[model samples]
Target: MDKHGNSYDKALDVFEKLLDEPLQKVLSGPLPLARAVGLATTSGYRAAAIAESEGLLSRSTEGDYLRGPSTRTIGLSALGFGEFALVAEPVLIQLRQATRLTAFLAVAGNSQCMIGPHSRGRGLTFAVPQAQYYLPSLPVLDDERLAEISLSNRHEAVAAQRAAIAAVSEREDRQCIVGVLLPGLHEAATDDLRAHLRKASDLLRTQSEKLT
Candidate 1:
């Protein structure tokens, strides 16, 4: 038995092995035997009780177990992105998970902008103070190097002017302008990033049209 009352090593091993299998397969197939062996060897029951307390798992009315809805929601939102469908909170969580990095959702505020909410990856900590000031300018990147330059000098007046031009040039259906800042990136990666952002924006537009 280990600190969490389960054979920590065994539980981790089982968890890692089962990860490649679908949850339904693990729940309905012989994987439970592995779990049982792990449990018997350690404090599996105690660990399960603790997990239940933490809302990580739950028993169903039919006596089957399943992950909680919160977990499912996060999973679904990870690869899904649409502006209209993007609830700030869940999408932010999904972004952090998918990118394995910190992320933010900023919106225009009173003569400035604000980072509404953000999420950080597992074991990562972000120390940006709350209500950090955001400039009311957007960035346009004609190339990857420009993107890097815009982000590195986000507060500079010239960079802000360039961003504003880029945002306007890239605008489609609506005039909603926003800039994305990525850290430690090089110019070579700009093409892929631009393609992804364009797709994301399109998805958001589609969702918005459906709503109205």
Candidate 2:
């Protein structure tokens, strides 16, 4: 019997003996012993019987089986994979404050892009408030400068997002890379937006380092 009160030691000994034999020879050799043990109503008695039959346990003159030092098989439960949110809430708030422009957060999950909390500028004359829009497709950008600004300002976040993006790129359901962006900003404020995003990214990076 094992520490768990199961006769796994005998079962292991029988299994090891069976493993030494070739697959084709198993049926004619120790396989019958294993099958009998597996079908036994009492697992412990079955294991002992298999061990004795397989010559793993010695039989005494009185016909009693003597146990031997052997390994055992222990059952294990499956482990769960926990979910984690990489970007912190403070980072989003900082990005909003720094840019004074609309800021968005996103993550890649289940072959789709999930947009998280977002903030918009209070004084903006144009542009709609798109807080939690799940864009099944990638963002359509008419201005190359704005795209560059977004990438540059959210460098670290973008890097993590790109890694996730690369994982799902081959799949048909895969969405665009994860990152933050400002929608419907003015063409004239592209440079300023870029500057603010850079500042926000830098601040976030600094805060992250301190936490480490």
Candidate 3:
């Protein structure tokens, strides 16, 4: 059984693998179905056929596999139909406008962060769109400590290419990390940026509480 108490099913595992492989190499272009069916068993090929027929996977003209219509529909629905996204979107936009930097909300857990809704900044920005980041240096948060983290200088050393300042707020049993991505912010403006980020995070918490 998994953490959700669902029994493991091999067929579902193979199906998920097929979807994940192409997405992992999305920038590199389509992946061959055979390659996606890593360690191809009889069941693997069967799963691929069903996924293609159900519009979860599509084949390129040259016969390589990429995500299909169903994936797009699901992604769109996730962004459009969520109360969390709706509440965060306006706050993110405000944060971006105030700081001239990309602002985002991510679900923080399991030593990794999965970025969700975000507002993009103008000109050049170091925004990590639809990306998952693993930070070994970040310790698991206890309820009391889920307030904020000043990750500007520390994250500069950890990520090397990006710096972020974020705050964690729990609302309706969900822990959301709201932050801003700094492209090339001046050292003097760090304090102002942190203030804006905190205000945005507080707005999210207040709005989310109203929904409950």
Best by lDDT: 3
User: In candidate 2, which residue ranges exceed 4 Å CA deviation?
Assistant: 1-91, 108-111, 125-189
Candidate 3 lDDT over 1-212, as tens digits, reads 77554435665666687787876664232224545556455555676677888988887675667766676446534533244544665788898898777787775554545566567787766455556665443533434232333233223444422435455554343345777655743333366776786687677767766764
User: How close to the true structure is residue 130 of candidate 1, measured as C-alpha lDDT?
Assistant: 35
Best-performing candidate as measured by TM-score:
3
Clashes of each: 5, 0, 0
lDDT of 1 by residue, 71-90 (tens): 43343233232332244445
**Candidate 3 regions with alpha-carbon error over 4 angstroms:** 1-83, 126-130, 137-161, 171-174, 184-189
lDDT of each: 0.40, 0.37, 0.59
Note the residue pairs that clash in candidate 1. Answer: 83-204, 138-163, 139-163, 140-163, 140-166
Tens-digit lDDT track of model 2 for 1-212: 45755557764655655433222232322234345335343554565466656544544465433332121111000001011112334554565666555454443334234443344444652233332333334433333312322221122333121111111111233322223344432233455655554554454445545544
Model 3's TM-score against the true structure: 0.50
Q: C-alpha displacement of 88 in model 3, angstroms?
A: 1.0
Q: What is the alpha-carbon RMSD of candidate 1 to the true structure?
A: 13.7
After the best TM-score superposition of candidate 2, give how far the Cα of residue 206 lies from its true spot, in angstroms: 3.4
